[model samples]
Target: MGKVSSAIINTENVYGDLEVAAKASGVPVKDVDVDILAVHTKYMIGEGEIQSVEDLSIFDNDEFFLNPELHIEQSYRVRYYDKTVTEKTHLPKIAIASNKTLTKIRAKILADSEVRYTADLADELENAINRTLLKYGFLIGVRSNNLKNEVRRVASLIRVNGALIEDVIFDVAQGIEPLEPIDDAMIYHYKNKVENADDPNSSVLSVVSENETIIEYVKSKPGRNGRNLKGELIAVTEAKNENAVEIKTTEKIRKEEDDKSIRYIAISQGYVSDEGGVYDIKEKLEVNSVNLKTTGSIEAGLDSDVTINVTESDVLKDAIGPGMSIETSTLNVQGSVAEGASIKARSVTIGGLTHAKSAIESVDADIATHLGTLTCSGEAKIDRLEGGSVRARVVNVNVAVGGSITGEEVYINELNSNCTITAAKLVVINQLRGRDNRIIIDIMQTPEYAKNLKVYTDEKQTLGRELHKLKANLQDKLSLINSNTSSVGYVKKRIEELSATGTEAPASLLNKLKDYQSLVYEYNTIAKHYRTQKERYDEVIAILQKMQDMIFDSKVVNKGRWVELNDIKFELIEPRKSICYVTKENELARVITIRHLEIAGEHIYEIKKSNEMPQELL
Candidate 1:
């Protein structure tokens, strides 16, 4: 038979009511006989569901489309399942095996077979439909609408009319679709890194402050998964943002991740940079020079974890601009520091001269040449010092023309300085020149020692007074002993004469002589006590002298011949507190040194000239 389509006769095949559905969907009905299965409903419902639909006169719906074959095959060779359809990234689809779809009418079958229909017949039809769907690898949905009612309604029609009827529905093929990512990851740069380092204007580098945000990273997500009708898993596709810029973090820049994004921040003050998707915050920075034209003043703070290296070596121009101040953890300058500039750091190194008006402060410093104000808590080494005011723990200079230097220990190879020098330990110079120089040895250094010295000095003065009193008492005692010596001899003679004669002498004379003898014994006891007190006084004096001995411990040694002299002098500071004071006025010598000496119970600081120098100072 040729392919045919049945037109409904008054009866409609929509899921709900025939009359209402025809009017709503704009279909012609309620005219032909022997109802034709021509009405098509987009959404299928349970059988006879149209009976209760109250006011569905103007409802609209959309129909999902799927291809159907020309005719239905009912043979043993018919294949119900199509395997060519597969699930895509976000869409899953399957094909229908047959062109026509029809619902089995239980009542029609009963009427044709001359058997009475019961509610059990509907159950049987549903069972059979389920079996068919299972055979085609379909697992969920569709059957939830309950096909029992559909079967019973068809059976009711057959019982009333006593004829078979056809119920048809077109099913659109659908399956589970895989989940897909919606957006891609992105990177945003907050600080633009220098692309070229060789640029001439890069004399002084620009740096980002600590804890500044460098980059913001927006992360991507992978969506959820899905399954198909065949019970197979569908994996989700990850989002790949091709246009998003990628920036990697370096060690100097720490990364912090939150619920949504990752942040790159500079942990130290330094040059922030990005190169080929790599982000870096460099703590070590190199600049050609620091001036108003090239770069502004850099004050990142002393503890900013930054090291700056100035590479400009021109002696004519300043490495640090005038009136500019720099404070960093470490600073190295190859060129001269200009006037009115100030530098403070943990460590400082200068390859060129520091000008007069500039000032530098550091824990430790090394300067090629210095003619400025400098204060160092640690050691300071200078190639040449001239007319500068410097103070440090230990000062070493190759050549000192003129400078006011104060240090615990000062060592100079060549000195033509007319400036004042104060050191606690000693000032040793290989060659001396110029005049108006006053090298002083500072005795008061450590506070604890100084305080103890003061106490001992007071004790020493008291002991000296006690010793003077003891001396006067001992002189009187000696005179008594001298005067009583003749009398004691005469009494001894008288006692011997009496003993020889075995004669009884007067008791009064003997008693008087005996009392006279006790006087010498008493004098002997008092002399022993005086000696002990004198020793104690000497001990106190020694302690006081040791405390003042640092002045003598310090010295000014001019090892080589004096090049020139004009009222040059060397003096021990705090003369009263020192064990001995050294003095020199316009004294010219080849090798001048102050020596501590004891001559005739007197302390002396002897200034002498010699060629030999101390081996330790060498």
Candidate 2:
């Protein structure tokens, strides 16, 4: 037998050619055998033989090979040689085996162009590989360089998963410059871009994120009725000034440690504590008003005025403890104050009743207390004050009982008899005269009243001196007028005698008559001067009398309102007895007697009827 050459063909049409060649070579056609080898590397490795073709047309020439027998030993040897070469190339074998599986995936990814290979697909591939490798007593080491190279090569043909794509995106993100946050009304779209670093035409861009925001503006879109709502519309605008970003979130998340909820809304520049309290306001904290509903207290720092309104009762009891004080520039409290709580501020006003033992001190304080003491440097207006002392520059009380009130001006609608009142200027009580009430009116000894009295006395003395001088001048004028009148009468009698004589008298006699006539004129002039002086003297006398009356009135009602003691046997404590002004004969007069008076000093005085006075005293 000669050496037979064999040629492998991947098409089924060549099988008939081999049969005809064998028959023409004097070999029997029945000896020709055609074998089709499936071109898949999995089937090519195990048996070194062709598998059966289930469907003839389904097998493509590129995926299947047709092998015909030459019957010579050389053709058989050539077939064995080609199989050995295919089995030794492991990389190409793996690629060829996975090609059909990867073709469908690549086509799917390329169809969308933006489709990303996700981590789930990569995980499935890893799991399948692990399961297959484990059955062969081997494990796929993910960290191996050979596997990494193979995966990169395979991914280049197909599409890498999302995990790798995300890595690339992150790298690009790190290189990008950070952008300033925009707070205006605008639309922004963030895109993922792939650019050839070298070729601008190779760039691709796709949107990754999009955002739209709205802000306030002056002129905005019209409403449904074509009417411009005052503050409802929003317009597109740009930020004018750049400042540090401030994020104000109204949704407050309370800490787990706190047992209560605190809500604070700030409309101005102010600092709110994490615990929901406002303090340390640099400017005046002006809101509609501060209203506390629960158990909370507000404290304004120095120079900050605060107006607090608490509608709930017993809410401030725990906040304002005994001896604890709330101080502010101006404090306005509309709730009841706890007992023994002291408040010191520039101005304090309490709309509710203050409890007992609470001391309030301010420049101007207005409070209603059951038994709280109020000390105001300026003015105090109290309502229903009972069993507490009040000392202020000016005090006005609706009702006072068993409390010592001392002020420059004190006004009480109803004063209990057990209360002691001391006022420098005035004390007015509608209902006075309860037991043991000490009403002390310090008048003459008071510096303010004493100064006024001194002024009055000096004026009266000066007026009296002017009156005496005028009277003296008038008296001299009267005397001169009387003398001139006598002279004038004598001159007039001589003139009449001369006229009756009707003869040419001596020049000396005529001159004497003329001198007498001049005397008559002088007398008339002196009479006119005397009358004018008498009128001035009378006016001065009237003024002097008025000043004397005023001096007496000043001793009683100089700086304070004179009390009308309405038949009440209440003891009056006065600095001087004469300071009491009593009504007698429809006129106000100083007390004259010490009868029925518990006098502290020797100047005690009493009031008496017109008939009760002694004959000499009247």
Candidate 3:
């Protein structure tokens, strides 16, 4: 018969469903025959076949059909075969091999033979074997007959000769000749003999010579003008053995021998000695300039200039010895500065507290003190001041209570009662309370008036000097005129005598008369000019006197602000006015209403007698 044409059906049912299988195979069910044998073996043995849709119910919906071959070789059968055989045979064979397997074999061989294999050498061997097999064929067949014999020979050689096979294989694969093996014992013996001969190139011999030279050089004396092995100069000096050598240097010496000896001022953490005098200190005693923590007090000798710093709870107890003040160059102290000491320095800073009776004088003073006196020429800052006097160019106080403060500019954050503050230009107080607080701000002299005063004073002095010179000139002129008057009188008397005789006057008398007349006219003219100058001098004197009086009248007029006040009544002394003395008999003083007391807000009050006080007063 001719070839039998059939559709291979892939289905999941045990009984072949021909219609579903035909649909899955894209064929008409009636035109194709059903084959149950393909379905029973899961399409592995043969293609499947199904008869009708009812047959699909017996199969799971998840079951899928794989694409089936139109023609499968049902007559062929696979047989057991070894992959190592490459010769042609009745069965096809597959070779199982990889780089990992070859690497493991190489490692085992190297371990057994006491031989080492680098990664490069191992990789080369693996590549040669794998390349040789892959190039021929992984499956043995008739064309790979010679290759099969070569692989079997290499495997047999490696199994029998072990790692020695690597050398032979490497030489064959890489086209290199085999190297001869070395005798380790004989090599070691020769190496030892060569080292004992003291060759210059040998590291061991060089090290030995170097050690001996070092030992000999250390034992030898350090001679001057000597050359080392490298021909370098070597200097030597004779001296006794000591722990350390001290070389005296004068590079940074600050004082000369003729100058006063230096002294060390130490403020330790204990009670201080009261020995009053300068103490010689061989070395400069250095202290930290920052916040220094201490526990006790500090006492210094008389006339000592020192810089002291302290922190924590400590006080400067002793008096800054009598007849000795801190120098203007040194002397600095910080922390709790106690009383009974007068400190004078360039600058003084108290970080903690400043007690009473501590008279601190400096160019600049900064104190976080409660109550203390500070007299600084530059600037002063205090934290809380009470019942003390502060005089400085600029004063800044956080809180002031019952103190007298005087400065060019005074700034107070809080002002309590009974504090007398005077500033030349400004007095700024944020919160003002309590009664009897006197805040006086002196209005500075106006620039215009100041300039005028300077000009007027200069003019007055100049005019005074001119007046003195003019007075002297006037006196001299008067004396000369007086002498000429006597000459004129004598000439007139002679003229009169000649006229009474009824005779003609002589030429000598006429000449004398003419000369005397000329002198008189000149004297009168000078006297008239003198009177003009005298009038001018008198006018100038009057003007200068007026200017002097104006300058004297230019006084500092005080202005102030009582921002907030308590119920206590206080007196405000008006500027340029005398203090009003209130008494029972002084009715005029009571009647006089001074407009200086200006209440800022709307407050109602009544002026009552000193004896008649209201029970409820606002």
On TM-score, the candidate that comes out on top is: 1
Q: Rate the local accuracy (lDDT) of all candidates.
A: 0.60, 0.42, 0.41
| Model 1 stretches astray by more than 4 angstroms | 1-248, 251-254, 265-278, 301-305, 445-545, 563-612
lDDT of 2 by residue, 1-618 (tens): 012433344432333455655565444545443332222211132345644333323222211221112010001111111222233211111111112111111001122233344434333333333333322322123112233343443344335442223211000000011123343221111111222323322211111111111111122222221101110112223433332222233322111212221222233322232223322123233322232332222344334444333332344443344444555566666556666676777887776676677888788987756467788878888888778778887788888777878776677777664676766545555554344565554433234555765665566566567656656765675575566666656766776777799855567656765765665566566556656655665665565445333332211111112234422121232222333433322333322222343457554345432223223222
**Which 10 residues in a row give candidate 2 its minimum summed lDDT?**
167-176
Stronger candidate by TM-score (1 vs 3): 1
Better candidate number, 2 or 3, judged by TM-score: 3
Worst 10 residues of 1 by lDDT: 66-75
List, in order, the clash count of every candidate structure: 5, 5, 5
- Model 1 has a clash total of 5
Among all windows of 10 consecutive residues in model 3, the one with the lowest summed lDDT is: 209-218
How do all models score by TM-score?
A: 0.44, 0.31, 0.32
Better of 1 and 2 by TM-score: 1
Question: Tens-digit lDDT track for model 1 on 1-618?
Answer: 011222232322222343443344344434211211121222223332332222222121111111111111111111111112311121111123422121111111222433335555444444444434444544322213334565566556555655433432333223334557755554444424422335433323346678987677666666655434333345567676564564577788888888667778888777665567687777887889887677666654577578999999988888887877777889999999998988999999999998899999999999999999999988899998888888988899888888888888888887774867777777787766666666766655434555786777777788788878877877887788788778777877887798889977678668867776676667777778778878988897777666555555566677655543333234453355333233344344534445677799986766555655678766
Better of 1 and 3 by lDDT: 1
